[model samples]
Target: MCYLYNVESQNTKGPGHSRSLEVPPVRVLLFILATFLGFVLLELWLYWQSKDKPLQLGLWDLIFWGLLIFWSVRVEVRLPLNAGMSQLFLFALALVVLTPPWVAPLAAFLAQWGGSAWYKEFFNRSQDGLATAIAALVWILAQENPLYLGRWDLSDGVGIAAAAFSFFAVNSSLVAFVIHLDSQTPLREIWRRNMGWVALSYILLSPLALLLARAYETPLLGGWGGWTVLFFLIPLYYSRFYWDEKVRLEEAFDTTLELLMNALEAKDPMTRLHSERVADIARDLARKVKDGDEAYAQAIYRAARLHDIGKIAIPEAVLLKPGTLTPEEFALIQSHTTKGAELLSPARKVAFDQLVYNVILHHHERWDGRGYPKRLAGHEIPEEARIVGLADAYEAMTAGRPYRKAKTPEEALREVQELSGHQFDPRLVEAFTELWEQNPIWRDRHAYLAAKEGSVSRSTSPQRSSASASPSPSEPGPRTSEE
Candidate 1:
């Protein structure tokens, strides 16, 4: 289940595919209920803070709120951020600066209504108003009379930045959490993938939002005089367009890669979805090994997936062969590592990473120096390749192959343990061994369910060493897992 930018929708319960994925009913209700409670609490706090002043709505305020509702609904982008992007923050900042504390949440609700209708999603509205209200409350609490925001002084930079930071930080965290709940993906991965890159975007845009708010009040350039603010605003829209295009291009790339995976599977049924499973497993292994380097973990996942993509160039006869291959045939098959590296070299134009290439070329190399075109050993092999190397082997062992029956998870784990420090990096083996204990059936369960209860039972079996290499397309190297 490889996820695209939209994240994987394994159990899509939306009315139709036209709508983006939604939070489950239970979570949505919980989130909405929490928002309502928070809204009530903030209102009470603002009332006390404002010396018991009643929240009043005047016609002029209504006019401004209407403009906010309009822009927030119409202007939006899908940046690297998981949440849908909206310049609504611009007007929310304005409301906080120009109006009293209680008005911000009221305006947020009205503004979110417009966006809800535009997106036609109830869950979207939940997060939309929820974040703005929180941001408004933060601004109110910060300045008591954040009315100073009307001044837009560089002297108050610390306070202004604090409110602005709270707004985005709370909003991004809330949205990322919802995404994690909906997707059942790890929360850390979700944050790194969706929220990490958006931080700079938010930083660059926050001051502009405040600037626009301040400019709107100046008699010389405000709307009351003329549309002078448009001069500063048109560029932000352009930037939004640029970011939107970037997201679209990324989607296109993911779709293209998915299509390639489909083609690879079609060419050889033995490999059908094998890479995806390996990718999932490899990612988990990478997390255990590195703990926090998400980008590197993703690279390892992609590398594991494409480790055998070079097989695309090998003759189908050799790929699908059901018996032991001759020496020449084995050698031809082994060339896939180099061939894959060559095939992917052009991706540099698209900013494809060097680690992907390294993993593809070196995944077959053993830790003990007995493997591959380079015969690289131990620390000489890239750690990324080592991670995928163990993952690839695990997948091959647990899965049934054309040449031999699948080993149970226990058997596979035992074999991997035996190969530690020889076929696999000792450190990675320790990491994977932990995962094997935590969840031997992490990928799929059929094998583990039927596997012998203990590794000791499988110790006497004949191991697939050099002579058994290249038994079939399924088992194609001295190390079947790397193959």
Candidate 2:
């Protein structure tokens, strides 16, 4: 009983408190080591696949990376200084100067100078550079924190996790920003493509850094090295996806524009065959003038297809009249050029807007200053548009209409050559004649039309249908070589 009493006194807290604690640091270290090895192997495999080609860095690329890094470091260093609005003013000024040198100079200048003017003129009358400076200061302060030290801490397990997350955040942000700026791609698209890279890099590199930190007891090595690897990986990942998407989207846009042109042909049944013939002739002429110039070929095709879109506004009575139009009717018909310009203006917001808009607006302008609308002449008419105009005239003259008999191929060519300087661009006419002479199909179509003079039906006149009419010769009766 006495021994029991003594033992109870020793355990005065009312319990047997004699348990040993196990830290298990070695087990944690081993786990981290294993994770690091796995990640290294995966990264090696990915790098081997992607590193087949040599890295050719451009001047602009170097400039952009240098500026980004500089800005990042500056933010890191000045965060704790409490420099207020002055710091922000300096940052904005630096951006204004540096951005133009890397991005488009004209775009940067307009955004900087014109944007400031617009803001002052419209939104805030009293706001000045100081106000902008203050706003920038607020933004910098929000992003800065002393504990961050421009790097993540990975001494403890929690710190390792934090470091991994930060690596992803920083690298992903940089990649997305660069892609958006360089490719002129949408922000959402950049994010969609780059997010996977961020994830993969984190999965592969974070564990390795954590293991190295634990093994070496130098946490900075793992944290900093992991971030560097992520930085390089981000751009690599984006390059693969960006180029793939760019090519696909470009091809899709080209196809869509071509289909739209074809639709324009379908709108007018009578003009469908004529448009095709003109497009062929115009394309040939364009090749002669500017051989292998894709821009010229595309412009010719677009202009020829839309040359008669203005005719949509013309009345059926005037379009299909068996005889010549009255002075007022002819004037109304001439208004098609302006109407076409108006119709195509809305579509100018698309990808090849400038080229398409030029064709739609200026195809009717003649070599001389006597053309309608703007009366632009010679080189001002646009070379491709001039080619289309010439081809259109040649096709219209050779193709019989209800009002007039089709001319012989020789007569049409002679007429086109005669009115070269007055009605069309002389150089374009010369190119067109050369192309027409070389193509036998064109010669045969014209010969066939010339022989079937007065063969087109004037009974079912254009005044009957407000919509387009079909130009099939066999629908009513078979057409002979001569009517």
Candidate 3:
């Protein structure tokens, strides 16, 4: 296979023009033939590995291959065959000449469709494309340099440049074709996101090609390097894209939920900050009770935030009532829970939607089964709903409404504790009491203010002393019996 001995030595002195020895046409043909056979074998091995599941060749596949062949043919026809062209030209020409017309189309189709599908499932197309392009370029460059090619002959670098350029050009072009066939996502965006993987492909594969060229004492064609690069880079690119898309999707969902929350708050001004405050408190308590399970705590928080989402269906007049509600008005207010469940049920994709829906629908449920909508008792109520219930009561007591003064944090805690096992879960109440004890002074001040407003007077003693141990000025001097 060594043709170097037959070629005239450049150092030899000759009177006439030196004639270069040429390999027999048959030898060159055989070398070309063997390279393709090698490629076929490698492809067969790959096919076998993935053979259990047959690859689906669909309409998109046809389009992808068709575009690839068209471009590859165009590039082949356009290649300048001047002396400056590297040996890569000969190699590429031989391969193209040897390949059946149908092969290029098939390869093109597979590259395009397979690449696109892979990107959609697991990779960033642009990144993968970039890496592949870079790898192809480097491979082309290595092939053109006689020193690098191990042929001990100087050849122009044009072949390497052309090979690199054409390979990446074809790959990226195929990618674009696949993008067009896939979805409405802008091709440019897909390209941008996957470009890194493309660059990485080149970075990883070029060295392998160089090593193969050295080992075989021939150009690196029909080797495992290309397929290996694809196997590794494709999945890597896919994973990056998958993760990025997942995060973006999550953010979008979160933004939508926030918008919904805002709309709900807008509909009932009295509950403007109520849900948010309750969510914060519930999340805090859930963290304690759930043993630092952040996910569970988050679920509780979201449930609390959306606990009154059903109240959007309630009339504004009833929700913002400044005076005592009639029995009929109270009954109307009770309908918000079921309405909230109904509203959230349609938004099933929302994170923790079920938990939020349950909290919204059952936050009013008493531990004794006296709660509205569904009179679910004790453990029958979801834990998230239970947490939201405590948060709701705490926020209601500590925040002033039109008909009531804000209860002190301490008074709120006391009321919740009193209602444990009757209105609130006993375990939740214990957690609330622990939280309140951490800030006694703030709690007492709010309790005094709540008592002064006469909002909680029906529940708490009107003559109770202030935290200062002094009788409240607002206390009536004495109760007057009929004189």
Candidate 4:
């Protein structure tokens, strides 16, 4: 998998890229602006083209649009890819099969425009209008007039399927285009990541669109397909409610983990920000490793932040000791891993996976056969553990410790590079180095602090010497020169 770090796109910067709704880039705004004008032009052209058509618009089609407007405006289920899922599609098909191809998309645009304006969402009105116009235009290309075939059969159903799919495809493409412009995410990535399952949803739901078109088109059904949708509509509204509850539940889990982290932080005042920095590094590393999403990286980050929760079981005397730990005290401190895992044991009842527990328990393990608790060797430790372990070491080195003052970020990175294949995963070290180079905060912290303190700048070069007895970071290893 090609990670963004290796892609060399200056805009594909690392983790702390905030997406909190500030004013978007001018380019994104301009793109949306251009789309809105295109939609207006398309609507006018479609109107002019349909003005002289032999076919006349029907009352049932307008009724179907009203039903669509009511059901669609009531609820929208959020998705990772596009904005939301709603039931405007059922009528979109009705327009293609029973009325002019342009009607559904145009009606949907008008309904959405009115609704969004009432809700004071001027921006969404623009998005709705453009997206609908695209869907309408594509549907028109597929069907010059409504399919007037009588006595439905497999071939007839296939035409319905094809027409509906075309509209959905064009609609999704428009939405994806805007998302690409707004997020600066790669267009291909957005389609693969966000639109893959969306296509599936459209496929699965196309039959309902077909059914609605059939019910309304056949005079025997009395145009009650609009009311028939109530069955699915009720469940869809409830689904949105259920999804909201699930979101709250996920937030509650995060808050509980944060509380545990806070309790652990109470034991070591100096290391309060330690877990957060490690989480930041671990998140970036996880994203590089899997080509995973920002959300997945954040999950790793949340898990990393809780890696030290077991330390809450340790007494302050050993945990906060001003000097190096004695053998027994160190062993006791090490037991916090097992203790931390035990503390989190009950969370399994609620479906918490072993990944977080593995990270907490084995983050201290080494790449070589020499680590604590289980004494596991390379690849024996969980991948999450190896990642958090490296992040912990870097943070521990850069962060001032009870035993010694903090090393510069440069020294910490050198220590990380040297430990690869000895204490840390060599691959993860390489990944970390890639991320570290991208984010400036990791390198700038110490220098800015020194400047503010009016102290002479300490050399951040890798040649610094420390002779601590601990096997960690004191003696640089053979692979120190690799990168």
Q: What is the C-alpha lDDT of each candidate?
A: 0.65, 0.45, 0.49, 0.62
TM-score, candidate 3, is: 0.47
Query: Candidate 1's residue-wise lDDT over 1-483, tens digit each?
Result: 001123233455555643344444577457656755666676667656764655454676557555755565566665443445666666666666666666665666555443232222444444445556566666655654433446574433454566667777766666666666555666777677556656677666676656665666674554341254556657767876876786687678667667767877788866655787778788888877787678777777766777788988988898866557787887888898999889888886574687888888988888988778698999999888888888888888766555555677888888888888878898898888888777744444343323423332222222223334344333324335534
Candidate 4 runs further than 4 Å off: 1-29, 54-64, 77-85, 93-96, 113-120, 141-203, 219-223, 292-299, 440-483
lDDT of 3 by residue, 1-483 (tens): 000001122233455533332222343334334433434454454345434643433555334334533332222211111000011212222222223222322242233222112223122222222323333334434454545357644332433344445554544444343333333344544443333223444324333333322333332446623333234335434543554465466567658668878997678644545566677778878888888666677678766777777767878887765555566766777888887777767667645556777787887777888676788899999888888887777776666555445566666676777777877789988887786677632244334335435343333322222232221121122100000
Backbone clashes in candidate 2 total 0
> Which of candidates 3 and 4 is the stronger one according to TM-score?
4
List the candidate 3 regions with Cα displacement exceeding 4 Å. Answer: 1-227, 349-352, 439-483
Error of 1 at 248 (Å): 1.6
Instruction: Give lDDT tens digits, candidate 4, residues 1-483.
Output: 000001112242456643232344687567656756776787787778776754455666586566666456545554443344455665556565666545655666666522221212333444454445555555555454444457533544565566556656655665667667656666765665445534665666667666666655454434555456554557656644765465457557768877777877777766655677678778878888878666566667878988888888889887876655577777887788898889889876464677888888898888886776688989999898998888888877776555555667778788888778988889998988988887645454454335435552334322223344243231233212100
Ranking by TM-score: 1, 4, 3, 2
Q: What are the RMSDs of all candidates, in order?
A: 6.5, 25.5, 23.2, 8.2
Candidate whose lDDT is highest = 1
TM-score of each prediction: 0.82, 0.43, 0.47, 0.74
Q: How much lDDT does candidate 2 score?
A: 0.45
Ranking of all predicted structures according to lDDT, beginning with the best and ending with the worst:
1, 4, 3, 2
